[model samples]
Target: MNKALLMCLLILPGHAIALVIDSSKPIEISANMVVIDERKNISTYIGKASITQGSLILNAEIIQLFSNQQSVIKIIAKGTHKQLAHYQQNQPNQSRFIEARALNITYLIEQELVHLKGKAHLVQGFDSFSGGTLDYDIKNDKIITSMSKDGTQRVRFKIKL
Candidate 1:
């Protein structure tokens, strides 16, 4: 297998794959509104913010992450979401991947799944995938995506990997 794919499989826990982010520096973010509810202990960053964690980069107009008394429970990102690009490197190999755009995304930590609504698309090498609503189970390497109520004009892909 390719090094990136192998790394994804090796670093992943059980069936979960690792979304790696490799950068020389931390991601810089600028936002209009950043709210932290000390009472509830939830923090939200809104209005044109970007986040980079390892090899993954996410940009959205609004990104909200909720945490309970202990840990983060949910993360919701919306408004013109997109992935700039990604790169991976391993022993004697390297590769790059990119995504065009993402609409609305909700991540449920407890459920270990990421839900993407609206126009979502993923691109890798010469292959591409687009769908209206997509649900990915990070823990199981499974994807359950479907079209909206807009008839057959929409595309969907459901895979259990």
Candidate 2:
């Protein structure tokens, strides 16, 4: 399989992390269009899907969620999707720990991994990283980001404490 394809599969719903809350019901979504396939246990929101989970916020032009199984198995996102993963640290101030964006994104619940393709970018406070493609293992807190190796292009980043 292609690297991009592998990354996508790794981040699909059933492949990522165990759900912290199973009773969490679906909330209302306002978008241009929405479709739910009960037979497949899949829900698709298009033309802008905004999902909020506690401090986490996600925005995507299209989002496909698999919810039929005991666990959420796969998530396919496309078109300018952005994610903000926030939390409260030891400090008094709330922290936006991580923000990410991509043309397409996928999360595998069982694998606890996230894959971002096409102009992927990630920001964490003063530190920021960007690449043509990215793969993040959320459970292990590992990230692999890369750009085309050709000499005609350049990839730049900035990090500050």
Candidate 3:
């Protein structure tokens, strides 16, 4: 019901997007510390932050929820350059789950878009994709990915039999 709760619900994208959000479900977040700035309408979680909604889980070094007076605006999860923020969602109807990892991950509440950057990796069912960045437009159900063109780095995708 509240913006902070909505932001936590979104860390689990599978339930938020694929299965459609069940807003009535409880959203939980755990971390070394959590701070909420009521004046700014922002919530920040630091140090091995973990957020869970239903069967979906997200882990990162920091998670920030930004909101306006009306509602949540954006949610960001950041990991150390050497480490990676991780998200996994289970889709019961599809009988499959999706997993993603990246140095930074952002979810735009207004557009329902997700962006992953810095050595991003995503896996859905038997297909896996790895690149420097990944963007998913949930509204359109479209995915766009790219990687550094230095020849040393290229987009990689795999589909297992």
Candidate 4:
């Protein structure tokens, strides 16, 4: 809730976006209700939760923060089928920003990884990716996607030169 507490929770090993300016900017979170459990080191935000910092923004119906020893270890955001959780961050010195959306999004800060499931979609500049599941390795700049087991959903990509 407080600035110091939010900053401490976000200053992890690898940032979601490698934006220098974004980190310097303050983080802002908005939601209908927030529940913090100090003993469990977990914080939950219910009802149209949104977090913003500089050019970065994340929105979901429910957002949960998991921390260990005052440092954030993981973050999970969930949304309904009609309105998927969304994440966006501006690229350094670029007009276009990277965007992602899914029914559920899991961010592993220390590992520098992001998992997107249920109608996952990611877009950067003019390139785009969509699938049933998407695993993004932030540190390695690699992405792995898969189709649904029932074969109803398939992987799709659109890249522009």
Backbone Cα, N, C clashes tallied per candidate: 5, 18, 0, 0
Model 1: weakest 10-residue lDDT segment is: 84-93
Best-first order by TM-score: 4, 3, 2, 1
Q: What is the Cα-based TM-score of model 2?
A: 0.68
The sequence of per-residue lDDT tens digits that candidate 4 reaches over residues 26-121 is 667788887877678777888999878788788999988787764667889999998999988776544588788999999886786889999999
Per-residue accuracy of model 1 over 1-161 as CA lDDT, tens digit each = 55533432222222121132342434433457766665765556777765554554556778765666555567677765254212111211224344435577776767866677777655433445567776756557455667776854287443333
Residue pair clashes in candidate 1: 20-55, 21-54, 21-55, 22-54, 22-55
**TM-scores for every candidate against the unseen true structure:** 0.62, 0.68, 0.77, 0.84
lDDT of 2 by residue, 71-97 (tens): 457777777425422111111121545
Among all candidates shown, the one with the greatest TM-score: 4
State the lDDT at 143 in candidate 3: 70
| Candidate 2 lDDT trough over 10 residues, lowest sum | 85-94
Name model 2 segments beyond 4 Å from true.
Answer: 1-28, 80-95, 148-154
Displacement of residue 88 (Cα, Å) in model 4 is 0.6
Better of 2 and 4 by lDDT: 4
The whole-model lDDT of each prediction reads: 0.53, 0.58, 0.73, 0.78
Give the Å shift of residue 158 in candidate 4: 0.8
lDDT tens per residue, model 3, 1-161 = 76755654443333332234433455677888777777777788999998776665778999887776555677789988777999776644334777788989987857867788888888877888888888866567567889855544478999887
What are the candidates' C-alpha RMSDs?
A: 10.5, 9.3, 4.7, 3.4
Instruction: Score candidate 4 by TM-score against the native.
Output: 0.84
